[model samples]
Target chain A: MKNFEQRLQRLEYLADRIKEPDLPIEEAMKVFEEGMTLSKGLRKELESLQGKVEMITNGPDDQGGPDMVPFQEVKE
Target chain B: MHLKKPHVDAIVIAMGFPAKEKAAADSSPLLTVSELTSLIKGNLEASFPDVTVEGEISNAKLASSGHFYFSLKDENSIIQAVMFKSKLAALGFAPSDGLRVRAHGAISVYAQRGQYQLIVQSLRKAGTGDILAMLEERKRLLASQGYFDAERKKALPRFPGRVAIVTSPTGAAIHDILNVLGRRNSAIDIVILPAPVQGAEAAPAIAKRIEQANRLDIADVIVVCRGGGSLEDLLPFSETVVVKAIAASRIPVISAVGHEIDWALSDFAADLRAPTPSAAAELVAESREVLLRELDQFQAVLESTMRSKLDALGASLEVFSPELVKARFEILSLPIVNRLDDAHEALVNSIKGLLADLDHWIALACSIIETASPQAVLKRGFSIVRRVGKTQAVSASAGQAAASRGGNEIVRSSTGLEPGEHLHISFAEGSALADVREVNE
Candidate 1:
């Protein structure tokens, strides 16, 4: 998600730069291409629908990572 | 001392009338005032050893010793109560005047004041009104400490990787949060810090779990949540421990306690307050659809910006096309070209006029030359005369004929001729060679 946000921000910046009246054509073209690439990548990521629903039931690992497992709903 | 019966009887008979008769009539022993008071105190203490009394508190004061002295009163009756400093320190809420409470204590007699009062060991707000008052007091205190200051509130992470929920494992709050999160964004890692959402142990357990979550430093945000319940059921959320924990947390806290209408102190102290547990989950992670929409909008904007830039470039390229440039150049240079043409025409006309003037002058010069010509003068019957010698030497020379042909000098007047000088005269049609026979002046 953080990566996505950063990419989106970069895309926005590129878009803004492309709008500059005096920007060199070569630089504008490069920025526009980069913006397109980031936009496509973000869109693909959003479309992939990749995620996990994990629950941390124990303390963090020695490396300070969560000890997570797939969450199972307990029905009452 | 051994003759006490006779002496006492004698003293009593002297001091009061019918002492024996009164004692016999009452069928009881006579007791002093201090002894009777002590007997009553023992009886009262024994009767109400550990009683729980409910009433509104009045005249509540916290003495310098930290003990709380108050009167518990109902509609018609009131009882003096005292909660020692030690017990008062353990209380979750402040005891104040007019707050209804249930106090558990032992009834003891104040022998000095001759009054019976309750020695309270524990105290609790008895109803919603008193609970609200206690919560209000706590809110005021925490507020003064800047616990709920907007400046102190941490902003929630826009995208939280991990979210720790401090809620009951078996309550509806957990299930609702999980469901909402699962539906919206399953990417978030959930840590369930299970604690009782109700009852006496709930507040501390919740606070401990919040602290543990912070200690671990794993979650980007913490959510303290509970499902809808009555005010009494939601009291734990309003507890000072829980509120303080929420206030002091480094990680941003989202409080979603009870229903939308139920307000808890945790709600005020937390960085954000959600109306429901599900709402908190939603706040933690944006839905995939929403993110997709945002991405699409961004892409559209980026593409449009690039397209407009390309269009502008195309427009400039069109403006600079070769044919268009030539046409514009011509248009821009039209006045200068016209001026040059006019200048060229004027120059040609002036030159022609100058040549014509030169032609007239040449004609006048040619006529003057024809009139001044020697042939024309000769044709007018005039004769040319010349002396065939050097003026510096008057004598005839041997090369005279040669000098006559090559170096003859013309005489402007007869007086200029010398006597005996050889002369050559030429008419327009013929020539003559002669000698000056006489002196002429």
Candidate 2:
């Protein structure tokens, strides 16, 4: 989410800039294309992000806590 | 070590109190009051040099010498005890009436007062004290150290990529948090860092887990939480070590220690505080739907804004004439025409033919419009028919009969018309009157 949040903010800024008036045609095209690319990027990110819960055992030499396991089954 | 009653009796006898030493006054030796008191003190002190006693504190008084004097009593017996200022100060807490305490001291007597007492060497709360006040003092100390400052708190990740929970693995807090996060389908990675949530060792374990989470650097935010419990049970979260650990966390921390009414020190020190574990989970990880909605908004805003920009850019060009653009193309083609002399002539002839074709289409459009024009139709011998004055409109068989009786009505058909009915006939040039002589049906 940290990455997602920062990228979303940047995308919003670019989208706003694309609507800036008096922009040269060439420059507007560049900004517009960038916005479209970012829009696709966000969608791709959304498609890939499925909620996952993992647990790490706290022990010495834990290898950066990467011994990840899903959280216990969710109760109703 | 505990001495049996008979063994204590043996020590007392050795200290010069014989079991059957009573004799006639005339034969018995006389002893001074101080001597008897010293003898009793020695016997008692030697028998119980160090003993631990538990009883409710009564008549508690702090003397001018900074000594704490109190009477500890059970249902049957009471013992006066005094703790020197050194031991009292080391307690780091005040003792008051009605508090049960465990006092450790030696049993002796004051020779001057000729009374027995216990010399208190150390004191501890046996069962209960003002827990709230103690918690407040600790809270104040930590607050002064700026551990609970709003500035020290980190902004929770609006979209947390990973969440770490520092709590007992089996406690209801974990289950509650899991339920909430699960219900929302938070598209975030979660790691449960197991820690004790209650009891004497809970504080240290909780603080240690927070440190581990930080050292691991795996979570974007941390939720330190537990389910509802008694104030005493929640004491660990209020411990200074736990509060400081939450403050020092490199990742954002959300503390949810107990039910809504409980406000632990950890809550104050955390980046965010929720009343319950479930609420903390909800606060830390936004739902997948919410993220999708935000993404959708950005895309929608981008599309609509792009459309409007394009529309504005095309506004000026919308009025340009197509024929003028083609003429400009012809002018620009001259250099190519000059490069190929023979082809230039043929090109000119083809362009001429294209112009002729365009002229023919233009003429055809004009003639089509003229044919549909009312005035042009009229010039070609067409006229309009309309009823004038009082007349019958031959729209229907019944309408003819009804108009013939005496009513003036519009006539579209000559159903039941009598000869010599007046009409208004209009051509493109002028209008005139006419009579219907025959019926056409």
Residue-by-residue lDDT tens digits, candidate 1, B1-441: 545545544544554435555453234356675765686677778879999999999999999998899999999999999999999989876777767789999999998888999999999878766767888898899899888899989987565666888888778998998888767755667878778899999999888878777877868889999998767889899888998899889999999997666789999999999998988888876745566676677777767877887888899799999999999999999999999999999999999999999999999999999999988999999977777643334333433454456676677878767676777666787666667788656
The residue pairs found clashing in candidate 2 are A1-B161, A51-B187, B393-B410, B393-B411, B394-B411
lDDT of 2 by residue, B1-441 (tens): 244444544544678786576444344445576766677887777888999999988999999999988899999999998888988888845777766788888987888887778898888777535786788889888889899888887887667777888888788898988788778766667788877788998988888888888887878888999987666778899999999889889999999987776678998999889989988887765545576677677777767877777787688776566877787777888777677887878899999999999999999999999888978988899765545443444344334344345444555677666567666555788655677777667
Residue B114 of model 1 has an lDDT of 85
Q: Estimated TM-score per prediction?
A: 0.59, 0.51
Total clashing residue pairs per candidate?
0, 5
DockQ of 2: 0.29
What is the two-chain DockQ of model 1?
A: 0.32
Looking at model 1, residue B386 earns an lDDT score of 73
In model 2, what is the error at residue B314, expressed in angstroms?
1.1
Docking class of 1: acceptable
lDDT of 2 by residue, A1-76 (tens): 3367777788778777766777776776777777777768877776677767666775523455357677675432
Q: Which ten-residue region of model 2 chain B has the weakest summed lDDT?
A: B394-403
Off by over 4 Å in 1: A1-49, A59-65, B1-140, B168-171, B185-189, B194-205, B228-235, B261-263, B285-335, B390-406, B416-420
Give candidate 2 regions above 4 Å deviation.
Answer: A60-66, A73-76, B1-129, B285-287, B323-441
The TM-score that candidate 1 achieves is: 0.59
